[model samples]
Target: MKKTAVKKTASRRPRARLKKSPLPFVDPAGQNGLNPEPPRAIFLEQPAVYPGTAPKAPGFELPPDYGDTKIALFAKDPWWLYAYWEVAEPDKAREAIRGLGLAVQRTVLRVYELATDSRAAERVSFFDILVGSTTGDWFIDVGQPDKCWMTELGFVADNGRFFALVGSEAVRTPRFGVSDVVDEEWSFSSELFWKIYRASGRIGAGASSYDVRAVVIESWQESAALQKKQLLLKGEGPSSFQSRGSA
Candidate 1:
């Protein structure tokens, strides 16, 4: 008997298993699964202290603020004066320049010499300086001393017109000669020197005191000699002793 051919279907190919990407490891917050809240920032307010008052604790001090646009004038010497300024608001300065209706070429400092008589009109002098958004201190030779001076910082236009931005308070330049009065009542009194000499003589009557005074004088002389030698070595020229000896 011919048996029907057994039908053997091809074994089905095994299905491919898709591999998933591993998740990143995250640190667990606490024993509980909930995340902990972030810490809040704390700020302690400090009380303001006045100038002469003693503070409970030493605190940081801030520098003085002279407002948006400030100019100051200081006497450097009999002939020179120093001027410094600050521009706090650049936008305001730019707006002022725009209002001038002239192209600014550079920054100009106008120094006005007020009349000593106060009745005469102020004499104006100008100095041109190339400055940027910020400027440092500047020195100007104001010539004569013992005169009142004031300064104005401004922008000089290409058309030679100046737009004054800020002005400084008037300051007096010191005279070249002795401007301060000498206290001759105490300094030139012969009786006071005589009393001091008598007291020193009584105190230095002991041999020990004499020896100490001699030692102090010798030490002072030696230090003076060393300082003179150092100055000479630094190219300050010959000392009086050297000059005399050479002569």
Candidate 2:
């Protein structure tokens, strides 16, 4: 009987919505409305002007200064010498050529052999070479080794007068068949002697031990006789011969 009573509830109300404003009208030809004015333009300020003399025109540049002429020489080998030179100031070279007062056809290289003594003026020999240009290199043949040499670059005048421009330092040629550093004495070791003897084929492949020994003894005796003969031919006295033979 208590479940038969039921309570009644009130109904809910819906909220009210606000309306949006309309957009402005636009013309397709870029004119929003009638009597529209054109847009104004902005520009940067100009540079200031000074009333005075005009700028000068650039002139031609001058030539650069150069160094003096130089010469050098070196020994290429026992019988050859190499010489080279450079003419830095060509104007000076031209002036000298003009001063020669001759029909200059070639540049001349004069080589001289100096004495062993440094302070001596005794020239052993002299020679000349003719070239087309002032600046060049040359390989000279100075025959006979072990000598001091000097050289100069110049031009020969019509009257045969030599006009020297540059000179090189003294250079010495090497000796023949030997180096500057000499050994007092030289000898072969027993091991090296045996190697050389075997390589010389004195003992054949089929030789026995006794046969090898006999061959070696015979070779030693022959070599000793030859050496003694050579010493006698070279004017060795009997005392020296006896001393060497005993040793």
Candidate 3:
């Protein structure tokens, strides 16, 4: 009975100790383990330059004068006429005018105010502009609107004889005001004209007739208020000067 089985406490088996091998020495920055490999070298390909990618050179210059004997005229607005002419070179001019016994002294632009639109119309008046030998262009002020004009590029002789070298075709200027020639089929009355004139003002729907009248009056007054410098003599008003080769 005393031999009571000493409850033998079951001894738990000891766990096996894992002996881990020493860890590899890491870099201070921890980027690589103990034996850090050398860094790799990267290569990049450069783009090729093409001939078309280069900048272009400056443009070619135009000749100042063509060795041709020609003249051109153009109308600028209702007041001015522009004329450009190219005479033959000195040698050519002399050769062409040889045996003419015309001793050229100076260049002159003879502006003729014609009576009609015909190229051979009767000359109503004439004026001369003394352009030096080297002038290639000129501006002529006829000072009369709705007239025909022709210009002649000629050399003035030392003895006052004018030798015409080249003449331009007659060009009629545009009428500055309303044309006098009315169509018989379409009679434009003064009332219609005034109506159109008022409509051109674009008066608002709510604008009264008095407002329209005021607008018309203001416009009329403004037109009448001319500057002293703009006032020409009785017949010296600017004509319709048009360029050549135009209708």
Candidate 1 lDDT over residue span 114-228, tens digit each: 8652414466544455554334568888788888888877777778877778888888788898748776422434544444455466545534556556655655676678778
Q: What are the TM-scores, per candidate, against the unseen true structure?
A: 0.42, 0.44, 0.51
In order, candidate lDDTs are 0.69, 0.74, 0.72
lDDT of 2 at 131: 67
Candidate that scores best on lDDT: 2
Better of 1 and 2 by TM-score: 2
List all candidate RMSDs to the true structure. Answer: 26.5, 20.2, 20.4
The TM-score, computed over Cα atoms with residue i paired to residue i, of candidate 1 is 0.42
Candidate 3 or 2, higher TM-score: 3
Task: For candidate 3, give the lDDT.
Answer: 0.72
Comparing 1 and 3 by lDDT, which wins?
Answer: 3
Candidate 2 per-residue C-alpha lDDT over 1-247 given as tens digits, one digit per residue, 9 for 90 to 100? 5677677786777667667766655555668674435678988697666767556679987444235488899999889999988667655765776775664445789999989634245678889988666688899999869889888898776667777888888888888885657453233347546744665667454545665577666667766787788878887968777888999
Q: Pick the candidate with the highest TM-score.
A: 3
Model 3 segments more than 4 A misplaced: 1-57, 95-102, 187-247
